[model samples]
Target chain A: MSLAELQRMTRGRGEPRVKQETPDNKAALAFLGPWLVGVVALTIGPMAASLYLAFTDYNLLEDPRWVGLANFTRMLGDERLHKSLEVTFTYVLFGVPGQLIVALGLAVLLDRGMRGLTFYRSAFYLPSLLGSSVAIAVLWRLIFGGTGLFNSLLGAIGIPSSTSWIADPDTALATIVLLHVWTFGSPMVIFLAGLRQIPREYYEAASTDGAGPWKQFRSITLPLLTPIIFFNLVLAVINSFQAFTQAFVVSGGRGGPSDSTLFYTLYLYQEGFGAFRMGYASALAWLLVVIIGAFTLINFWASRYWVHYDD
Target chain B: MRLTTSSARRTAAAAASIVVLAGLTACGTGSAPGAGSDGAAPELSEEEVTLRATWWGGDSRHPLTQKAIDAFEEKYPNIDVVGEFADWGGYWDKLATQTAGGNAPDIMQMDELYLASYADRGALYDLERTAQLDTSGLDPKVLDLGRSEGTLYGMPISTTAFGILANQDLLDELGLELPDTSTWTWEDLSDFATEVSEKSGGEVVGISALNNGYSLQLWARQHGEALFSDGSVSISPETLAAYFQQALDWTASGAAAPASHQAEMAGVGLDQTDFSTGKQALAFSQITQIPAYEAATGGATLEPVKIPSEDANEAKYSYLKPGMYWSVSSTSEHPAEAALFVDFMVNDPEVGGILGTDRGIPSNGAVRDSILDGLAPGEKSAADFVAAEEAYIGEAPEITPNGASELDTLIARYLQDVLFESQTPQEAAEAFIAELDGSIQSANQ
Candidate 1:
C-alpha cells in the first residue's frame, strides 16, 4: 500500500486496533525479554562505559583519571594515527567497490541455470567463511613472500619476480586490499537472492518490447537491484573500516615495513594493548565510530535518489 | 496507546536504574592489588591449591617448562600447577589483557624490557616481602636487575650475555680463522665480513645486520654512553647515526643480507635466522640461544665469540642480561605458593636439569654447577663462553625504562628505511631519537 492510503486507513481504525492489540502485549513483551536483556546488559552497558572512558587517561592497570578532551586533542599531532587513517581509507575506497563488482559478476553467472548450482555456490562461499581467519592470513603471507608461490609462478613464465609482496611497503597495502577483495562470497549470496526475487515476467515483457539484455539490465535489473546494492555497500564500508586480522597477522603485529599496512583498528590495538594507552585508544575508537556512522548516514541519505522498493 | 507508552517509559526507567546499579557494583569490585589478602603473611597450607603459570616460548621450551611445573607439583603434592604458553608475538598482548582483567596467572615469565613497566604499575608482587622465596643463592647483581625503585619485583631465572654466534662450517669452508674478538674494532670486523662474503661467492653474507636495540645498546656502551639513563635518551644522536651508518655500509658492501631479505628474516625464531639457515656466517645472539641454533643446524658446530668493540681494551660492552624472570602476580590469590614455585624452579637440581639453558644459563651457582657436567657439547660451549666473558662483563644497565620495548621495532623500522635508501642514516637517527624520546615521555606520564 502507498503511504497516503495506509495513513488514511490508520486514522479511521487506530483506536479500535490499539484496544484489540492490548490483550496480546504481555505475550509480545515475554518474547522480547531475552533480546531486551541482552541489549541492556552487554551492548548498551559497555558502550556507555567506553564513552566515558574516551575522555579519561586510563592505563588499564590504574584507575581512569578524567583528563577531558586531552585524548581527542592528541590525535591532532599523532603521525601514526594519520597514517592509519590514510591506509584504512585507501583500503575502503578500492576494496569495497572491487569486492562488490566481483560479487555481482559471480552472482550473475550463477543466476543462469548452471548444473551443480549448490556445489558451485558453496565452493565460491568458502573464502568469505575463511577470509578473516588467521590461517588464511598466514597462507597469504606464504603466497606472497620473497620466494613464495606467486613469485614461483612468475618465474615459471620467465619473469623472475623476486620482490616480497607483503614485505615491500610499496606493495604491502595492496596485498591486504587483494585479500579483502578475495572474500566476495557473502555479498554474492545476497545478490543472488535479490536476483531470484525479480520476476521472470519482467524479463519476458522486456524481451517482447524488443529490449536486448544490456538494455533490460540497465532499465529493469539495475534499478530494481539498487536497494540490495545499497545494503551491501553499507555493510562493506563498515567491514572495510574495521579490517584488522589480515593486516595484524601479515605484519606480525608490529605494523611494519614502515607501517604501510597499519589499519585503523590495528593501530588502536597497538596503542591500547601494545603501548598501554587505553584512554587514547578509547578516544580513537570513538572517532572511528563517528567516521563509520557518518559514511553510513551519507549512504542512507543518497539511497533515496536511486533505490526502488515498488513498481 | 496511552497505556502502552506509559508502560514503555516505566520499562526504560527500570533499565536505566539497573544499569546504574551495575556501574556502582563494578566500581566496588575494582579489587585493589594486594588489598584483600594479607600480602606479608600469606600462610602456607596443606590444603589443595591450584595456580596458573604462564610463559612464552617455542614448542621445545613449553614441554620443558611443563616438566618443571610437574616436578614442582610432585614435590609440593598440595599444589596443582596449570601451564599457559604462547608464542612471543601474542604473549604480551594476552598478558596485558589478562592482567587488566585481574586474572593474570600466579606466576608469569617476564622480560627485562617489560619488567619495570609491570612492576611500576603494581601488577607484580615484591619478592623480598614474599618470605617464602629464597634468593640467597642468586647473585646480588643478577637479583638487582629484577628490582624496580627499591624492591625486587621479579626473580632472575637465568643470565645470558649478548655476543656473536658464528656458523663454523661456513667459516671453515672459507679457510678463515675467527677474528680475534678481544682486539678487533668494528672496521676490522667489517673487512673480515667482506672477505667472507666474497669468498662464499655471495652465497652467504658475512653478517646478518640486526635491528636490535640491545645491539645498539652495546654499540652505545662501546662509545661510553647508555642507550637509556634515568628515564631518558642518554646516547647522542651522533653515536646512533654512526651505528646505523655501519649497518648501511654492511648492506652496501654485500656483507649483510639485502634489505628485502633482512625484512623477511625479522622476528623469525632461532631455527629460521640466516645464521642458523647457513645464509650468514655471523649473527647477533644471546649466549642462551646457542643451543637452539645448534639444534636448528642439526648439530653443526656453532660457536660464540664476543661482540666486537670499537677501541682496544677500552670498551666494556658485554653484560650479563637476566634471560627472563619468574614473577609472582600482585593479584595472585596464592602468593606464597607462587613464591615457593619460583624458588623450586631456581634451586631444585632436578627442575634445573629438566629445564637446562632454554631459559638461559641458570642464575643460581649451585644449579649451574649441577647442570654443567650433563650438558651437551653445544650447551657446554655456551656455558663456557659465559664463564670466560665474566671478567670483561660490565655492570648491567638500568632495567629498561617503560616504552623501551617499542624502541626495538622503531629502530628496525628506521633501519629498514636506511637500507631501502628512503632515509639517510643521519635522518633515520634523528627520527629515531625524536620518536624514542616522545614514547618515553608519554610512557612516564
Candidate 2:
C-alpha cells in the first residue's frame, strides 16, 4: 500500500489522535528494561528452569532426564524429607508466631513515652539487622554454649548449668527459635510504624469511655495494629520457611546438632548444590514455593477473621 | 480494548518491531562468544589474552595469590590474569552457577570435597590429556585426588594433614608430655585432657572440645571405620556408637568443652578458640591451617601431630589431603591454555617461590622443594614437619560418596545434640546414621 493511500484510509478515524511525547514512558521503558532483564535472567530464569528440573533427573553434570514426578514420589518415601518437613513445619509453627508476638509486644513497649527509647529501640533492632549475619550467628553459638556467656552468667548466680544447651536435639531447635525471636526488631519496627499510624484519639476516646489501660489495648491498640501484626505474621512465616543462612551458619551449613536446625531451604540448598541433586532440589524448591504460597494464602484467608484495617 | 483502523496497524507494527529488536539482541549476545566458533586454538595475535581466574580465600591468602598471578602475567606478557576471590563460605555455590551458565573461569581453585561433583558434572576439563601434564614430579597421593574415572580433572596445588595442634607451653606447665602421636589412642587423649583440667584446677583442658571434620574423620579411623567406603555410606554402627560415646564422655567429664561451646566453635572454626588464645593445650586442624594458627596465637610455637588413633599401623586415621586443586572448566574453548597455566602455577619455580607453601606444599615434588627452600624460617619448619609425616601416611583411602560433604554436617549436628542436651550417645548415633543414610539415598536417586 502506498503511504498516501494508507494515510487517506485512516484520515476519517475520529479527530486525528494527537501523538503525545511521553518522556516518562520512554524513561520508564529505559529504566525498567534492565530490571526486567535481571528478573528474567537472575530470578525467573532459574525459577523456570527449576520448574522444568523438578520432573527430571538433572545432576549438574549431565543432561536432565525427565522422570515425570518420580522425585515427588520419592519424597513421599523419604523419611529424611518427612523429618525435615516436620522440623520445618515445627519451626514455622513456633518461630513465626513467637517472633510476631514478641516483636509486637516490644514495639508497643518501645512506643510508650520512656527515657532512652532510641537506645533501647536500636539495641533491640540491632539483632534484627545482624541476626542473619555470620558473626551474630557465631556469637549466638558462643552465648549459648555450655561454657558460654549464658551458662557463665547462670553460674555466677549460683545456678548449676550443663555445658550443652545448643547440642541437645530437644533444645537445638528451641535455641534457633530464640534466635528468631531475638531478631524481632524488623517486625518491631514495622509494628512501631503501624502503632504510630493509629490516631491518638482512639486510645483517648477509649480512656474517656472508662476503659482501663488493658481494655484500651484490647479494644483499640490490638485491633488497630492487626494489619501490621498480620503483615509481620505472614512475613515471619515465609522467612521461617526459607530460613537458611542462620541454620547454615549456626550448624556450620550442616543443619545439625542432629538435623534439628535443618530449615527447609537449607535442605534444598544441600540437595541442589552440596549433593548435586539439582533435579530433586528443583522439586524441593517448587514444593517450597507451594508451601510458602499456601501458608501465605492461608494467612491471608485467616486475616479475614482478625485483621482490622480501620479505614 | 478495541483499536481503530490505524491504531491496530500501529500496535501490530510495534509488536513486530519489538520481536525483531529482541531477536537481534538475543542473536547479538549469542553470537559474541561464537566469534571464536571453531573449537580449534585461536590464531596467534599480538592482543593479550585476558584470562579470568577465581578462587576462595581469606584476606591473608588474597594478597599472596594476587602477587603470584601478577608475577605470572609479568612472565607471560600475552596473558593478562584477572583474579576473583571470596571467602570459603559460599564459594561452591558461585562456582556451580558459573559452571551452569557456561561462563566458568579459565582456572578455578577447587576443593577435594567438590572435585568429584564438579568433574562428574563435566563442569571441569580433563587436564591430563589437554595439558599432557607430566606427573613425574607430583606427589602420587595428591595426584590421586585430582583423578576421576582414570582421567585427571585437576592438578593438586598443595597438601594438608589434619591433626591436633598442642600448645607445647601449656603442656609443659602441666608437666604433661605430648603423647606418642603415632601410637596414641582416643582414650589416651581424653584421659590426658581430663587429668590436665583436674590438675590445673579447671584452668585448662587438654584440648579444645570441638566437633570438627577432622574429629569425625579421626573417630572413623580410630574404630577401623570409613565414613564412606567404595562410594557408599559405610560407617559401621559400632564405629558410630564409639564416636558418639567418646564425644559425650569428654563433654560429661568436662575433659572437653561442652557440645554447645564446640558448636559455637564450629562456625568460628577451631582456629579461633582458647587453644589459639594459649589456654587449651590441644586443638584439631589441618597442617595448612598452621599459618592461621600461628598468627592467631601471636607467633606462639605450634606443631602439627597426628590425630591419636587406636591402631598405630592403620593409616585410615591420617592421610595427606589436597589443600586445593587447579581445575580447567570443561566448557573452556582453550583447555590446553588453561592446563598450561595450571602447569606453570604448579611447577614453575618462580610461581612456587611467590606462593611459597601458601597453598600447602605444592603437589609437584620439584615445586614443593622450591617452596620449601624459599620459605621463611617458620614456614620452613612446617614444611619439614610435613615431610616427616608424609613418610608415615599409608595407602590413601578411596574417594568418598558423592554426598560425602553432607556427612560433615551430620557429625557436627550429632555432636551438637550431645553437648546441648542430655541426649545419649545412642540417640545421637542413631540420628546420625539415619540422617547419613537418608542423604546418601537421596543422592543416589
lDDT of each: 0.84, 0.73
The sequence of per-residue lDDT tens digits that candidate 2 reaches over residues B1-445 is: 1233366446445554554344223311122231233555433335657777899977777888888888877777887778988778678777766665556787899877677666655566666555335667786876886786666777888887777777777777888787677688778888888888887887787765445555565567656676666666677776776677776788789887655556655655545677887667777767667777788888777777777765664554457777888987766655555666777888888888777777787778877776565676656666777787766666666554555555555566666666665467677677677776666565555
User: Chain A only: TM-score of every candidate?
Assistant: 0.91, 0.89
What tens digits encode model 1's per-residue C-alpha lDDT throughout B1-445? 5688688767866785677455533432136555345545676778999999999998889989888888888889999999999988689988887776667789999988888778777788878777788898888878888988868988999998788888888899889887788777778888989998999898888997757777888888888889888878888989999988998899889988777777767745677777877888988888778878888887778888887776775666667888899998887888889999999998888989999888889999999999999998888998999888778767777777776667777788788888878888898888888988887787677
- The residue-by-residue lDDT of candidate 1 on A1-311, one tens digit each, is 68965765568643354343665677777898898788777777666667777897776765677899999999999988999999999999999999999998899889887999999999999999999999999998889988799999999999999898888888989998999999999999999999999999999999999999899889988888998999999999999999999998888876767788889999999888877888889899999999999999999999989888975
Instruction: Let me know the DockQ for model 1.
Output: 0.41
Model 2 chain B poorest 10 in a row by lDDT: B26-35
Task: Score residue B140 of candidate 2 by CA lDDT.
Answer: 80
Candidate 2 CAPRI assessment class: acceptable
Candidate 1 docking band = acceptable
User: After TM-score superposition, what is the CA distance of residue B141 in candidate 2 from its true location, in Å?
Assistant: 4.2
lDDT of 2 by residue, A117-194 (tens): 989988988998999898988887778776679888999999979656666566778888888888888999899998
User: DockQ (Cα-based) per candidate?
Assistant: 0.41, 0.27
